[model samples]
Target: MYKYDNYDQQMVDARVSEFRDQVARRIAGTLTEDQFKPLRLKNGLYLQLHAYMLRVAIPYGTLSGAQMRLLGDIADKYDRGYGHFTTRQNIQYNWIKLADTPDILADLAKVEMHAIQTSGNCIRNISSDQFAGAAADEIVDPRPYAELLRQWSSFHPEFDYLPRKFKIAVIASETDRAAMKLHDIGIRLRHDDAGAIVADFYVGGGMGRTPMIAPLIGDGIAIDHMVTYTEAALRVYNRHGRRDNKYKARIKILVHEIGADSYRSQVEAEFAHLQTLELEPPAAELARIQAMFVPPAFDTTAPDSVDRSDPDFAVWLDNNVHAHKQPGYALVTISLKPIGGIPGDASADQIRLMADLAQKHSFDELRVTHAQNIVLPHVKKADLYALWQMLEANGLGTPNLDLITDIIACPGLDYCSLANARSIPLAQKISQRFADQGRQQDLGELKLKISGCINACGHHHAGHIGVLGVDRKGVENYQLSLGGSEGADTSLGQITGPGFSEDGIVDAIEKATEVYLVKRENGERFVDTYRRVGMAPFKEAIYG
Candidate 1:
């Protein structure tokens, strides 16, 4: 995990103090709601459906045990008894009071975390592979570059008031776990034939009113020139991105209007100028940032004392865990998407227990996956039994990590001001709809994501079966999308057809799955079968 330097600590501390005064002034009526809106948003505070929601950044989805404990404390003491881990690798408290936000920011500052850039139109939290250093498939760790981008974009003057929020994701492996195509800017870190680290840049990829897969802008860009190249891309967006209609303001729209080739050429022209300015971060500075991210030492000895035969524990070990790079260790995902529970919502106690477990058994490192789950990235294989026992007691041991029951849903009408219908209850309903463990396992690897509106915060566009809620004459209606994926071969789902009533939507999903089961080849997953057969079968099965 990356530790904050003196400059980092000072900036956050100063921001916290400054925001405290701003909050006090707003409360005292010296500033109106309109006056305080941008200021509060800049600090990651948003007025939600019922109350204020505070989104705190967890840089690159990495958290120290102490940091996780602090987050648990914040959830317990401040507003609600739980927090929602989001797809952007950040956490949101949906029931925060306006008065407690500054205090919360101060507490986050204590642990070298803050809400800065978690919101606002500037580059939001720079996300990367949750399994960055520990994943066996990684070509290089992407966190150092993410951190560098974080520092550069923290309060960038030119981009502070962009047309819309900008998101950037970096993936170091050939397989894209961070959903790079879904970000405004996506960087793929790879090495050249000569074995030097370089980046492949994708720009204008986003989801919302107009979803677009980012087009490749540059290939084999030297790692040293990352910041310069990124700035060039941003500069192009800043100059030409829409400013007239808020709906058309994202870079994706610009990419569509201008065409990918022209956009790439424009970015390259800008990059040529930036390259002349000697703007590449110095080698020593890069080394200094890289030093902060060195992996923790692991115990090599595999303890032979523990039994792995416990049926319940073994199921969790097999489904909820992944292989770690180190011998005798594994990466464990604690599924927040327990059957009949809200996806990505963990109570304060569960959060604390996870912190404790991370410290005790996983070298104090934790990660939040893009699938909206928590991960202990390096747990000893031998200690799996004891870890499962602790997790079971804490209500965090759900043996459905990537199954049909493990849904990813947004805070819809229940909390989000922009939502049309409640997503949490819908997710709960869907989970309960297929609550049988045997049934869910039989269904296999079906990702169901729901969003209240077209903002696509839940990434409904990327689900194997994406459910989107809409208001049809003040009545809640749901739309279904098929064949979407957020993994290595990322693609936006195609809509099945007309929207359905809430209950109809669930039935529609079941029908779609049934269609897959009938048409699937041997060993084919839902996505694989859908891709093979296309939407004709699904459309016929559901609508016919």
Candidate 2:
């Protein structure tokens, strides 16, 4: 984990002091709600349906045990007893007092974390593969590059207010675990034919009112020119992106209106201009950042095998464990989505326990995944059982990774004022319907996502089974889509026709799964089956 230097610490401390005064003004009636909206939003504060929600950034989804402990403390002391880990690799507290936000930020500053840029029109938290350094197949760790971009973008005057919010993702592997193509800008680092790392830039990708998989605008870009190329891309978008209509403001919309070829040409022109100005960070700076991310020391003699004698442990090992880059170690995903529970909500005690486990068993580091799970990235294989026992006791050991019950859902109407219908209840109902562990295992690798609206905050556009809640004449209507995937081969789902009532949607999902089971060939997952047979079967099953 990267530790903050004196400058980083000082900047955060300054922001905390500044915001404390701003918050005091708001509470004292010197600033009205309308006047304070943008000010609070820049600090990641939101006035939700029931209360204020504070979103804290976990840059590139990486945090240390101490940071995790602080988050738990914040949840217990400031807001509710639990916090919601979001799809963007951030955490949100649903019940927050306006007066406590500065104090909470002050607490975060102590641990090198903050709420800055988690919201507002500027670039949001830069996301990356949760398994960045730990994944076995990655060419290199992508976090340092993500951090470089983070430093470049934070409070940059030119980009402080764009036509719309911007998002970026970086991934080193081809697996696309962070939904790379579903971001405003996606960077994939790979080794070129010359055995040098290069970045492939995918621009104009996003999900919302209009969903798009970004096209590869530039490939084989030299790693040294990464920031320059990114600045060029953003300059082009910031210049021509729509400001007339908020609905048409995303870079995807601009890219769609103007051809991809034209967009690429514009970015190249901007890149050429930036190259002349020597805008790319010096190589020494990159090396300095990379030094902070060296792999943890491993116990080379650690056991490479697990006993797996206990049936429950065996099941968890199969479902939740991932191969690690280091031998004799594994990446364990602690599922926050227990059956019949909110998908990403973890209690303060659970959070603290996870922090303790990370400190004791892992490398004192934890990662928040885009799937709303936590990763203990460097756990020794020999210690797996003990770790599992501790997590199981804390209600964090649900072995339902990518299963039907391991849902990704948004706060929805339950908390989000912008939501038209409730997503949490629907997610709960669906999970309860598929509570049978055997049934979920048989289904296999189904990424189910639900969103209260078209905002796609829950990434419904990329799920194998997607449920989008809409307002239909003041009643809640659930629209079902099938075959969407956020993988190396990214694709948006197709709607199954007429929307259903809340209960009807759950039954419809069951029917769609039945179709998959019957039509699927050997080794076929739900999305694979849908792609093979097309949406006709699912549409018939769901609509009928």
Candidate 3:
């Protein structure tokens, strides 16, 4: 992880001071809700249906154990003693009081973390693969470039206020773990024929009421010109993107309306102009940033094998453990989605425990995944059994990675003002419906996502079995979809027939999975079966 310099520290300190005053005036009744709306939003504060929610950015989903301890402290001392890890790899604290936010920001600043650009019509947090530097299959670590972009985009004068919120994601591996194509700007980092690092650009991908997979705009932009080309792309979108209606304000809609070819032409034109200005950073600075992300020291113990004597330990080893680049080590995912528990909620004590584990077992670092899980990216394989025991005792050791029980759901009506129905309870009920470990394992690699509304914060649009909540004539209703994916073979799901009530949605999911069980071929995932057979049979089973 990159450490903040004096300049970064000063900027964060200044922002905290500015927001502190603004919050004071709002409480003093000098500024009304409408007046304080943008001010608070710029600072990553939102007035939700029940209380205020504060979103803190975790850049590229990387953080130190020290930073994690600070976050745990904030959660324990401030709001509700628990924090929600979002799909964007950020953390949100609900039940926030306006007066205490400045204090919270002060504490975060002490640890080089902040809520800046976590919300508002700006270039939100830049995300990368959770396993950025640790992935065994990476072509190059994408975090150095991501950190460079973070410095370039933060409070840029030209893009301070875009037409809408913009997102950018970078991935360097063959597998698309970051869902890069589903971002406003997705950069694929790879080596060219000459083995030089290059970035392939994809523009205009997003999900909301209108969803789109960003089209490829440029093919081999040299690493040196990454920032320059990005400037060109954002300049085009900022200049021509829709501003009249919030519904059509995202760059994805602009690309869809103007056509990809025309948009590419405009970006190329802008690139031609930006190149003359020599906008890229100095080579030394880039090298310095890259050096910070170099791989950590590995112990030479190099054990020959892992102990999986216990049945539960073997299951966890199979589900939660991922291959690591270092010998005798593995990347372990601490599943926040314990069966019948909230998907991404980590209690303060659990957070502290993870920090302690990372400090002792790993190399004092951890990563947050876009799937709402935490990764100890460098755990020794020999330690798996002991780690599982600790995590199980803390309620963080559910071995349901990519299974039906590990559902991704948003705060929904429970915390979000824009939600149409409660997503948490629905997710819980559906999780319970498939609670049997053997049954979920039999289903094989199913992804279920739920969103309370069309905002898609829950990312229902990308699930294998997606459920969406809606208000039908003042009554809460849920809609089901199938075959949505957010991986290398990314595709949006198609809606299945009419909507169902809360309980009906859970039952509908059961019926649809049963159809998969009947129709699936050998070695086929639920998504594979759905894609092969299409939606007709599942729709018939659920509706009939």
Candidate 4:
């Protein structure tokens, strides 16, 4: 985890003080709702249908146990007794009071955390692979590069107010775990033929009303030039991106309107100009950031095998455990989505429990995943059972990683003013429908995602079986899509014929999976089967 320096501390502290004053004025009736809107948004406060929601940033999805503990404390003390982990690897607290937010922010600042850039029409939190430092296949940890971008973009005068909000993701592996192609700017860090680190830039990817997978704008860019290249891409978007309608304001829209070739040309011109200015952060600074991400020390003699004699433990190991870069260690995903429960809501006690487990067994570090789960990145294989037991006891041990039960859903009409229908209940019903572990495992690696509206907050466009909740003539309706994926071979889902009722959607999903089971080839997952046979079979099964 990267600790904040004096400058970082001072900057966040100052923001807290500034936001505190703004909040007080709003409470005092000096600033009207319209006047306070932008100010509050800048600080990551949203006035939802019921109450204010505060989104706190967890940069690159990495944090220490102490910081995790504070998030638990905030959930317990400030708002409700639980918090919702989001697809962007951030946490949202609903039911926040206007006055307590400053205090909540103050508490966050103590642990080098803040809500800055978590919202607003600016470059939001830079995301990365949750297993960045621990993934076996990545060329190098991408967090240093992500941190560099974060430092450069924070409060950047040039991009403070873009045409619309911007999102950037950095990943080092070929297996895109962070949904890189679904971001405004996605950088894949890899080694060139000459053994030098290079970045492949993908620009204009996003999911909203107009979803798109970003095209590769530039490739083989020297790692030293990452910042300049990113600046160039943003400059192009900031210059020509639409402002007349918020609907078409994202860079994805601009890239779609102007051909990718023309967008690439413009970015190239900007890159050429930026190169002349030599605007990249110094090498020493990058080295400093990299030093912070060096792998944790491992016990050389740690046993390489786990005793999976317990059938339940074996199931969890198969479903939730991932291979680690280090020998005798494994990456464990704490599933926030228990059957018949909210997808990403973790109680304060559960949060604290995860923090304690991370501290005791996983080298005091934790990661928030884009799938809305938590990761214990460096747990020893020898200690797997003990860790599993602790997690299981604490309600954090649902062994559904990519299965149907591990649904990624947003807080839809229940909490969000923009939501057309209740996503939480739908997600719960779907998970409960397929609650049997044997059934979920048989379905295999089905990434189900739901969004309340077209904003795509829950990343519905990226799921293997995606559901979008809509208001149909004042009644809640759900639409299903198939074959969407957020991996290296990124693709947006195609919608099935017509919308369904809430219960109908659940049955529709079951029908879609039935088509997969019947049509799937050997070793094929649900998405693979859908892709192989196309949407016709699934649509027929669901609609009929």
| Per-residue lDDT of candidate 3, residues 5-47 (tens digit) | 8998999999999889999999999999998887788788999
421 in model 4: Cα distance from truth in Å? 1.0
What lDDT score belongs to each candidate, Candidate 1 first?
Answer: 0.88, 0.93, 0.92, 0.93
lDDT of candidate model 2 versus the reference: 0.93
Q: What is the lDDT of residue 483 in candidate 4?
A: 81
What's the C-alpha lDDT at position 345 in model 1? Answer: 91
Candidate 2 residue lDDT tens string, 1-544: 7878998889888888888999999999999989888778889999999889999999999999999999999999998799999999999999999888999999999999999888888889999999999998899999999999998987778987899899999999988899999899999999999999999999999889799999999898999999999999999999999999998999999988998999999999999999999988999988999999999999999989999999999999999999998889999999999988998999999989999999999889999999999999999999999999988888888999999999999999999988988999999999999999999999999999999998988888898999999999999999999989997879999999999999999999999999999999999999999999998878887776
Candidate 4 lDDT over residue span 1-544, tens digit each: 7889999999999999999999889999999999898778878899899999999999999999999999999999988899999999999999899889999999999999999989889999999999989999999999999999999998888998899999999999989999999999999998999999999999989999999999998988998899999999999889899999999999999999999999999999999999999799999999998899888999978999999899999999999999998889999999999999998899999999899999999999999999999999999999999999988888888999999999999999999999999999999999999999999989999999999999999899999989999999999999999889998779999999889999999999999989988999999999998888998888788777
Residue pairs in collision within model 3: none
**In model 3, what lDDT does residue 162 have?**
92
Candidate 3 accuracy as TM-score: 0.99
How many residue pairs clash in each candidate at the backbone level? 0, 0, 0, 0
> Which sections of candidate 2 miss by over 4 Å?
none
